[model samples]
Target: MGFGDRWRQWMMSCISIPKLSVLINGSPTAQFGMERGLRQGDLLSPFLFNIVTEGLSSLFQKASNLGILRGANCGNGVLISNLQFADDTMLFLEPRVEYLRNARRILRCFELAAGLKLNFLKSRVVKVGMKWSKSNVWADALLCKEGSLPIPYLGLQLGARSNMKTFWNPIRNSIKKRLAPWKSKFLNKGGRLILIKAVLASIPAYYLSVYKIPAGVANDLEKLQSADGKFSVGSFRIQLEDSISDFSVDHKLVWQDCCPPKVEIFNWQVLRGHVMVRQVLHRFGVVQWWEVSSCLTDSIKTWFQGWHGLCPSISHRRVWDTLFAAVIWSIWESRNQLIFNGEDPSLTQAANIVKFRTALWFKHHGRGSKIPISTMLLNLIESCRESPPKKKIQKEEELIPPFSLGLKFNIDSSARCSPGDVGIGGILRNLLGKILGMFSEHIGVYDSNTAEMTAIHRAVTMCAETPGLIGKDIDIVSNSKVTVSWVNANGVGSLKHSKIIYDIRSCLISLGNSRVIFNSRASNSFADCLAKKGSAMEGDFLSREFQ
Candidate 1:
């Protein structure tokens, strides 16, 4: 397959003279060298197999081109001879004795040249838009079995009517087959949901992508997914109703946008008083009353009563719910860790995790309270109390040049999105505001902070490298206050890009009299424009020196 000498050598090393031993009845067979084909499970096996089979596709094409084999005619003057995926080959040809003979000859030629045996017994000659009797005749001629319409191809029925419910039965059966083994195994709601997503959801995706599923079939699949969870909930509700004179709770409160589905399910179980806490286990005679004495002294309502005092503002309901979910989920996880792993539970550690988790969630998903995550972690209640910053009137800000006869680098960075394509640009100007040099370059994929710090680093490096600007006092201006603060503070408390920050600091120190400063975006418009231009460019570093 036109492999280079080095590649060929590497591939041969991987597959040459491999020893194999078979175990029969707990006795190992003698080791034997694999002399015929590539060993099974080798990394290069698939590629080598594809390379061998590729010759067969070419042979079929060659036969069709030479008019030795007649291929099926697609619309718009397109003719298809054969389709090959991995080792499975499907030939499309005009129903003629001559074409079949030519196809057989081509396959034999490929088998001889490639030294790969074709399993004719496992192969099938499927006839389309032709008589059913002719299929057996063709199969006999090819020394293979006959196949009818709607035959399985790549785990999908090729000729089946997709709209019919029968076509979807295979997918449903596959999902059930996968779920059958899982049903016998005891799994939590989280584990079941993961299995449903990872295994069951993927089963129908292949079919759904090729054919639009009928609404009835879709509903049936949904029923299958929720069948176990619904049954459990119904049985528990029935039992609770039998015991209690009045047992009715609105389940809608359990589900919140702030919480994950598993957490919501857990909350639902908790609200229904179905959680197997020590008290519930004691009531069921599973645990003694002595064991339950120190456990769950407060009722469920009292446990969640902290939410009311946490965030009194009605506008911060989402934030409140997020914190509430974080707290409850943390407690649940802590309890599980203590019970399952036998770890000594620390309430303070759990509370800290809950606080940090809530702050993180609010930073990403929650509306209002646009405070820093550190500030939120320090005091969540006060942070939530502070409303989102109101829109202020736009004011013009002027760019201040260097105080002394030194160079000022107005640097700015632009990103398509956070953790996306980033570009850094800087304009070097003297004290009189004359542009000496300017650069616009797409750095790489990074957040805006990294991009901003990179711009400063690049500017400082440029200043240090330039002949005339060497030893000159430099002022690096930027619009990102966070980036500026991090740089000035020597990247203290900056966890994500500490290396980049240190590199920037090193560059600044190398410049001897350089410092990074903060400015409004309005004042750094030229650098911003250049950064945006760099972001749109094809990743080429463009630096222009003005005389």
Candidate 2:
């Protein structure tokens, strides 16, 4: 068939829809007809888009077979025709007239079938390892403009040398634009500080992820920020030693933790008698506050009452603890604003915010807590007493080991020395103690704590990946006191391996049914043996053999 004949045949095959009423403003204004296509803002737009684009994949596959289209062979001998993310598409093709013509034809066919038009004028063709004349000819044949190298895609330069000065200009210019308005004399110091923290400081972070900031650029930015002598409140990398030294005078117990580096710097200030917190308790006079303020004054509230106020019989222990945590969180947040952002610090304001936030956090986390904010603030003690009744929990005997309904994994790790060649091992069992799975890995030259952590991390991962195991109540048993504490607390410390902690916590939180608990080394003998075996091995191994 001829070209006109084929075009007519394709156009005649297109379907048209019946008349539909169109609403302009509030009233029906006209009747119109449109072919059935994917609706704008529909949840299934991406899925439908992929479905429509599947035709391109098939066309390109046939073209590859027919020797009409060629894509760059990226090492493993596999050819890549296109890279797609959401609505953005980058097509890779040999710079040739026939390929360009075929591409245009395929796109036109797709537009006819899916009723989604592609505007060639808006599209740009980028060339790589091709002559300028050849690339210009390809762009002309495709009826698209030639695009420059290093086009911005997904907030990153697609083909730019990341280390070059030109690559950083965009980020530098963006920061300048953001900081310009904040430099006005009309703006207050507090408002400027907020803008600087929120907007100016964050402008370059996206680009910074792609390339390290040069030393000169870093110094220039610091000069622009002019943040000398200001308290850097939000940084996770606080110099704890210097901070503790400053707060340590006359307060002997301020720096007390079994693990010294585990405690955050700001938390030590709000511990008990330090940082004007004594006056805060007196002002609020909430029973929970007063009870824990024994260090502030001897006669105010007893330590025993504070320590054992919420027995196992009380279901509101979580709620009460959340309230205390909310208080500290609010205090810290307020302190940041006051010191760093130039807001005047008020203990009363902090306490008031605590009460408000307590209600919000409790309602969100307490599984439908209906206690009103007014009641919580007015009679905080009574509100705690009036929480829902505690559910009766099955009491496990001290002699009998705790049983989980789904998978139970006893994990252990050992290093030849404290920081030497390490190995991790775990054995999975069901409720009846029949072994279901086992794993062992020699993770080279990590400390004992890291080795222990890796054991639990690998166990949780195995449980997640194994068939019929995900979303099941998986108990991870460990013998190390530090490891159990770290995992049980969801690794909420300032110690090293925060990235791993974040990853493991995210995984566990997603599972929702996973739990970490301590078990005696005697109880975890099999897993311990497997760890010793792993220490002798070269690498990782997993066995699904049930015993």
Candidate 3:
């Protein structure tokens, strides 16, 4: 059935607002039935042709180790565990690069082990929800036919959760488990400041060290250490010390830039308090928030309350202890933003937002003892404050690829649109910015998703044709991982549009590169911006940019 661009565009305008995300022809779309439409073709490949013999053996062994495959299942038979429709396919071999030597060994192993030829095209590893949860979004490494990053079944996107609530449980539970001892110790008689400081200073320093302030954020810690006195906040006279220091903090004292207030401090030690306070806030935050998502949410309200036959409203008394505290912190920050930066966010409005988001978070994920998925989301935004500056691509650099023989490669699509027209473009570059040529297509009436797919198709065509394009160190970059996964995840020849699939797979087989990558639109803005050019065939594709 043909798709409806007008209706989809109208719906897209309503739900996916422009401020929070990219406004395209529509929400990013994927090639859903790409693999389902495959027809009778030459399945002239070997079973383990994609991986090396040792890699193949190791792949089987890893499955056995994971308890995913054992006993009779381990025999030399081709082990295809999860294959639903022609679309979703997961193999049960040793999906590790450590097991194999170069890409060549991998190809021979497939023929030797499964007696099938390596269908280099249409074969790539996929991870769901790493960047985009849509069917096609994917990491580029998995797209590499040979040198491409192998999507080892045992390994996928790190820290990926199955559902919002369950995902945070382990982290949530671990935090609770660890803090329980400390909370108990603090409540101990004579626990006093020494013990309190010891627990606060050490536990966070050790446990959350992974969440350390990035080097860029702390780059001048030493210089600031000496100048701590210069940046003092109040009578407290705070500053960073080579060794940890302590000063009583009133949560009311410091200011934070986050709309929901953060404590302001003269010195960095405020962060120590912030961490513990935020921990407490987050703990109660999750507890209270989960109640709604797990219960009061509109769709799941009935089911949530119905869980375990308990009165949903009757949650533990302690859950609400810090509920207002978290809200207060948020309001405090928003008020400060309006006052100091003239941001103009009302205190009442800010509190409502915090409440709404907290409730929605729980509706999607419960605030159980486990770390909630929203926590990760929050942290991702917060961490950007400390992350190193992102590298911007230089202009006109990809015209000629760097020195490397035909190495393996992959391509990803990128697109961005405006009110009138949509711009679609694709770039084929390597780790080093060797331009292996790129393509741009424009559809006057298009949504963001369709434009994105067009870019991917164009990129695939370019990669498949030109000689020496086959096995060069290649990487495909796109802002949308969803597009990459949906189109590249399936077997090429299997798709009804077998030619597109075949061309992509053919590029992988021919190239000798590492992998394909899907980046955020901000990072891949260059090609995407290029793709949206002027009206002429070669006019600046970004029609909106000119205006």
Best by lDDT: 1
Per-residue lDDT of 117 in model 3:
65
Show where candidate 3 strays beyond 4 Å.
1-420, 434-438, 443-447, 491-499, 512-515, 534-547
Candidate 1: tens digits of C-alpha lDDT, residues 1-547: 4568998677666666678999999999999877667766877766876777777878887788899997898867999988878667788988887788778888788778977777889877775434468887788788889886679978899778788999999888887787776664533356557656566787888787889999999987876666553357655765676898864444444455555677777866776678989878988989777633346545676555555457567657666777777877788888888899998767788788988887876666554346888888887866755455577644432346664568778889998766667888888888777778899998878877788878887887777677676577888889889988888883363877687788878777777788888877767888888999888787566786744
Give the 10-residue window scoring lowest on summed lDDT in candidate 3. Answer: 31-40
Expressed as tens digits, the lDDT of each residue in 1-547 for candidate 2 is 1238776555434323335676778799677655655335645455665755766777777777888778767767888777777766667776668877887887798789777788999877785533478878888888989997779877888877776667777777876676666556523476457656666678788778777877777766665565433555533224464566553232222232211232224444455344445466566663234344334435212332353364444555554555544655665677678777899867787777777766665555454367776777786555655456667653332233446667678899876655667778888877766668888778877888888888888887766666577677888888888877766573475267566666677778767788888877877877888888787777578464434
After superposition, candidate 2 runs with Cα above 4 Å error: 1-46, 65-68, 71-80, 83-90, 115-119, 122-127, 147-155, 185-188, 227-547
Model 1 clashing-pair count: 0
The true-versus-predicted C-alpha distance at residue 391 of model 3, in Å, is 15
Q: Which pairs of residues clash in candidate 1, taking residues 3 or more apart in a chain or in different chains?
A: none
TM-score of model number 1: 0.33
lDDT of each: 0.76, 0.66, 0.42
Steric collisions counted per model: 0, 0, 77
TM-score, every prediction: 0.33, 0.33, 0.24
Superposed Cα deviation of residue 4, candidate 3 (Å): 39
Candidate 3 lDDT: 0.42
lDDT of 3 by residue, 1-547 (tens): 1338996575444434322334468775442222211222423223223322344556455545575543234546744432223223344334433222233344465568556565546555443212223213222323333212223233232333223333223433444454456543443445363554444334324323433343442333222222212334542333333233543333332232222232223122322434333334767664333333433334322322233234223232112212333454565567668678989876577756665444433333233325444553354222112223467765443443433433212232332222335556655555455544555555554555545555555554555555645544556555666556655675542344455555555655665462445655455545644554522233433221110
